[model samples]
Target: MTYRADPARYDSMQYRHSGRSGLKLPVISLGLWQNFGGTRDYPGAMEILGHAFDAGITHFDLANNYGPPAGSSEELFGQVMARDFRPYRDELIISTKAGYNMWPGPYGEFGSRKYLIASLDQSLKRMGLDYVDIFYSHRYDPNTPLEETVGALAQVVRQGKALYVGISSYPEAETREAHRILKQMGVATTIHQPSYSVLNRWIENDHTIDACGELGIGIIAFSPLAQGVLSGKYNSGAKEGTRAASSNTTLRASHVEPRVLEAVDKLGAIARARGQSMVQLALSWALRRKEMTSALVGVRTLDQLKDNLGVLNNLELSADEIAQIDEATKDGQMELHPSPKGWLR
Candidate 1:
């Protein structure tokens, strides 16, 4: 059966301005990073996405190389958009990225003008859209000159292929440089996508958050759930079939160590005091930041989306609760900066 999102769903969502830009993004955005990819479940993805829109999620994030088969997520999402979201196209904020490996050849990746332009064209084709609301350079290409990359992004804006450009996973230094160059080119470098969650504090300590606020760049934090680590779904001695059960090179089976799980347990206790789930506590914490325009997360099922949306109903975090969480993870259970590996898909 086809799903039709309720028009009244938008009433509960809070939209915040994207930096100094006129655009306002939903407080919670959906990201097609893992489950939407080929390795995960399809029906689960559809249910999650459908429920999210019905619960007032206006922004959906994607990338060229998101799926195991590369571009498969966008292709799948294109099908969903055609079947369900076609009527509400103007009400959505869709974004896709390039700069990571897409195809097999050298021209298939990187931030070169040739690669950027061609990749965007291919992404638009896969998504079945003429233009993406926001396009991102997935990562910094040290091999490509910053000027060349920024110029290509500006060109895309001028050509109307994308309304805005954003940078992801760039170091603080490179991010500042890119911001300068993009502004000089007359393109509003509206947003910066970085990883931030209770487990990942690199943005806070590394000045990425402060710099973006000072420069008027809105921040949309990706992986704010820490790849599902902050949801109280996994424990140190958890049995198989959990998120930490799979042992991959990027996120080792042991990454969910005893210390990490211990922190999660303690945090769960704090959440109980507030009458919320651990995931809701984590999402609400991310949104409390000044530079944070939105929290980008992935959902594997409709139940997860509904649970996550409940966080917005209670955004109040007291000073004592904040200090308690700070002490619980004093050693930092998960390190997000200079990420030891990529666990996105």
Candidate 2:
């Protein structure tokens, strides 16, 4: 069931510079953190992956612990690359991360040198690649020293296991320190993946945006749709058999609180005025930033991916529309410090 992509697929979306790097990443990137888990619908996942590539999505985000049964996502991704994408390796930008708990014991997780290095080696083996274009620390480790984590990332670049390094969920202060350390080690911190959306605006207050801008680090926003909250899918109430209704999910049934729903209703009205779906307006807002290199997104079906891709067609967000959205979500209905990684299940 392998698929081949058309050579002209690269012309679909406009590419943006990743920070100050020479690399040009597509505006919309694919992430394998959710639906790619082995236990999920495999045919659906592969179909969506093929569709994304055919639509000019060059970057794919992954991690060592991305499956319900950890490592299955990478294993399945390897099968995908081997069967369908092997020939297009040069045209792709593959990334994987380490930092979360992939295995038992102290050495198996965290920002320690031993853990980061070993996790990446295992990720490479699972994905059947010589090197990943970008490797990230899945999250910041408050317990570990910044120097140790940054040095481990530098070591990977030196070993040729990763071309560039990135950090995820790190604070602005930590980002600055990491950039300094990595630069001193002669390895640049090229990007940062953060959770940003019309519903979630923590990065604006956290200073990560300005810090990364100063350091020339690209920001690829994850969960830019606020896990589909801004999509108006839950506005009519949660449908059965959806990710929102899944009992095992961490998003919590309470996330759709009364205020959250009220905010969505108001936001939906604003989106209708612009003649776009709430999802499109939300995604467009995130990309309107001068420092945003890409918007990394995930989907359970090809239909969802298509709807998301429509954001690029109308990225124009008027000052008034942006103001309306800001006021609607001003109470901050999207701030959740919990790990969005359900694969650890």
Candidate 3:
């Protein structure tokens, strides 16, 4: 089928600037972290991509390490780029990251200049792209000199391989330092990716959110649904194939304990009263911050994706609603590994 985008694609979608940069990303971005990998159905992935774009989602986020076999997600997305998106390349904001282990040995991961440079080349090759709109250091490397890591990002921009650079899961001090280092190199730390949701509030407690806003670094929140905890799907219990039931998933069965389900019930009640689903309520809460550029969503089914996009129906959160959410989730904690050196999983 010839993929012609919806003629009215841009009519209802909203865009927000990444920090103070001129680049505007859709309020909701599709992420290729899970279901777009090689193990999934290729045609189904294409259908999701096609529909996402038709709904005015202009940003697609990926990482070099985003698959069961590692790099498979990028390879799958490369096919989509070659087939359906070549004509609309300039209309998209494609971003990829390095800094996780992609291969073996010393230079396989981290913030080394060698690893970043080599990784970007390999990523570009795998994705069939000359450059990514935004390149990110997926995590902070405590051992590597921050300057060395950020300097490689600057080099890629000058070399025309990446237009903008960002950092993810970096603490407040490191984020401030990365911005300063990039500024010295005549580059802006355009964005930050972090795990943020109504249940997980590390960014808020650790002051990472405040730091990005103060530094003019836009935040694109991942895991806004808290690994399905906020989706109200687990109020009864973890189903047979749910993420919490999977041994390899980051969301453990233990994380969805009785206390957590209780919080979900309270949150769901608040959402239903306002005529919004639990997922949309979670999204609305995450995007309530002005510094949030987009909320990155990973969906396995087209129906799930549509449910997430239903957030467009009600985007605003009143002060009272915000207060209610806070009170309900005050004691809620999803056992996550968040720190200055790493982010929540």
Candidate 4:
């Protein structure tokens, strides 16, 4: 069947400026990191993608090393784009990244100029895209100089392989340095992707959020639900096929300890008082920051996507509510697992 998007898709969706750039991204962006790989059902993936667009999710976030075999997600996305989204290409924001172990060799990953450039070329090919709206250096590399990584990103823009450049998981100091270097190269760092949620607040402690605000860089928070811990799905314990139950997944059952579940339970009660689900509350909290351009979420089903989009309807939180959430999760240490590509898994 030919997929025709809902004409009124944009009626309720809110678009926010990406940093100081002229581009605006949907506040609730979709991420193709998990459950959209080769092993997953193509028809099911297409259904979720179609529903996301129908509900005004224009930004689709991806990375080169997303799938188990690596690059399979992009390949799947390419097929979906060719089949259903070809005509609406101009209406979407596609972004991909590099900086993880994509291939076996040393040249296949990291922040080096050679790796970034080649990886993006491969990513563009896999996605069947001429250029991604944003190309990110997926993570900071301590081995490479800041100049080299920023230069590679700038070159991608100059080559028309990417419209803008971004960095992910860089520390505050490194993020500042990257922004400075990119600005000197005549291309300002457009956005910064980070892992932030009620249970995981590293960005706040590291001051990355404050730095991005000062530098005019947009923040798109990944793992806003703390790998479903904040979603209240695991509050009772890991069920079948949940991230905690899946062997191939990064989020393990050990990570969700008693303390974490207790925190989640308290948070859930707070969410109920606000008349929202735990997922909605977590997402709304992540977007509470003015510097947050979007809250990038990953979903396996269309129902999950719709529930995430409900965050847009009620984003307001009183100061007291914020305090209650803080107190609830303060004792829990449920940070996302560290991966080569940061916490977007």
Candidate 5:
């Protein structure tokens, strides 16, 4: 069957301007962090992608080291682009990142001119993209000189390999410095991708959110559901095939602490009162900030994808509801995906 995008795609989903820039991303963007990697997963990933675009989700986020085998997700995305999504390229906001351990040896990872430039090249090849909509340093490289790292990012824009550049999971001070350095180089540091959710408010505690707000950098929160801990999925126990039960996943079963589960149980009650599922509550809470441009979600199935999009139905939270949520979660039971004062995934 030919893939024709929904003519009403732009009708339902909401878009917020990314920082002060002219670019606006859908309030909910799809991320290919997992389950979009395997050769056998292609058909399923394709269907999810189609449904997402049909729902007005224009942005798709990825990283160089996203796949289980590393680099496979981009290959999968490229296959979809070639087969079904090629005609709709102009309607999509495709972004990828580097700066994690991709291959072995010194040049395979980190934020260096050598590694970043080479990684983006490989990513462009793998995704069959002439240029990505956004390219980010996947994590802050304390070992690398910030100048060299930011310089490579600026260079890519000048060379026309990336349309815009961003940073992910960076601490507050480094984020400010990166913005300054990019500004000096005549590039706008467009967005900041951080791990922010009800359970993990590292961005708020560390002042990263304030810094980005003051600097006019848009925020797109990843792990907004604490990798599904807040989804009421693991409140009972580690279900089969959940991220918590899987040893390969970043969110280990051990990470879903007992106290956090208790806190989430209370939240589930509140969600029911508000006529929302736990997933919708978490996502809506993340987007409550005016500075937030989008909330990035990774879905394994068409059902999960549609369920996530349901957050848009009533993103509004009453003041009393906010206070109730704050009190319920303020016990610091937020250890499920607890990020330390300075850094986290």
Candidate 6:
């Protein structure tokens, strides 16, 4: 069956201008970080992609080290693009990143010019694209000179491999510096992908959100549902195949302590009162800021995708609701993952 996009798809989804750039991204973007990888479930992945496009999600985010085998996600995405997305390429915003541990040996990871350039080359080959809409440095590499990493990112744009550049999980100061460097190189930082959610409010406390606003860089929050914690799915316990229960996932059972579950339960009450699901409330909270360009979400099924898109139905959050959510999560701590160089702290 031929996949024809829904003609009225643009009628509902909201699109926002990315920073000061000419690019306009859907407020809710799809991320292929998980469940769209490996050899199995190829059809399942395709179905999810199809549904996302049909729902007017124009952005698809990926990274080099996303899959279990490291790069399988891009390979899988490549196959899906070749089959379904090739005709609609111009209407899509496809982004990929490097900077995590990929492949063996010294040059396989980090922000070196050598690694970034080579990684995107492999990514392009894997995704079967002449150029990606946006390319990113997955994380800040303290060991590598910021100049080298930023220079490599600028080079990618100049070489026609990527139209825009961005950084993820970088601190506020580093984000400013990266933006400055890219500006000097005649390229503006399109967006900053950060791990921001009600539970994970490091962006607020660390002033990364303020920094991005000051610098006129758009923010796309990943894990806005706090890796499903805020989705109200774990109010009782982790179900089988949930990220918290899966050994391969970053979210562990320990991360979902009783206190956090209590916080989530309270938040769920607020969502129900407002006539929305927990997932939709979490996403809307993330997008409450004007500086936010989009909220990147990953889903395993078509139903989940539809639920996430339902966020656009009511992005409005009253001041009292915000206060209630703050009070609910005030006691909760930001769950920090250990980075390799201890710089993420």
- For model 4 the TM-score comes to 0.96
Candidate 6 lDDT trough over 10 residues, lowest sum: 336-345
Model 5 TM-score? Answer: 0.96
Q: What digit string (tens of lDDT, one per residue) describes model 6 on residues 78-195?
A: 9888988889999999999998888899999889999999999999999999999999988888899999999999999999999999998988889899999989889999899988
Model 4 lDDT, residue 268, Cα: 87
Which candidate order results from sorting by lDDT in descending order? 3, 4, 5, 6, 2, 1
Local accuracy of candidate 2 as per-residue lDDT tens digits, 225-335: 777777778778866655666644646544577788788888888888888888888888899989999998888878889988988788888888888988887764756
Mark the regions of model 6 whose C-alpha exceeds 4 Å error after superposition.
Answer: 335-345
Candidate 6 lDDT: 0.87
Please write out the lDDT profile of model 5 over residues 46-150, one tens digit for every residue: 789999999999999998887766888899999899989999999999999998778889898878899999999999999999999999988788888899999
Better of 2 and 4 by TM-score: 4
Candidate 5 lDDT at 74 equals 92
Candidate 3: worst-modelled 10 consecutive residues by lDDT: 336-345
Give Cα distance to truth, residue 157, candidate 1, Å: 0.7
Better of 2 and 6 by TM-score: 6
Question: Where does model 1 exceed 4 Å of error?
Answer: 39-44, 239-241, 245-250, 339-345
lDDT of 3 by residue, 74-150 (tens): 99989888988898999999999998888989999989999999999998999899999999999889899999999
Model 2 lDDT vs. the true structure?
0.84
**Per-prediction RMSD in angstroms?**
2.1, 2.2, 1.5, 1.6, 2.0, 1.7
Each candidate's TM vs. the true structure? 0.93, 0.94, 0.96, 0.96, 0.96, 0.96
The Cα local distance difference test for each model comes to: 0.83, 0.84, 0.88, 0.87, 0.87, 0.87
Residue-level lDDT for 76 in candidate 4: 94
Give the 10-residue window scoring lowest on summed lDDT in candidate 2: 336-345
Q: At residue 109, what lDDT does model 4 achieve?
A: 83
Off by over 4 Å in 5: 332-345
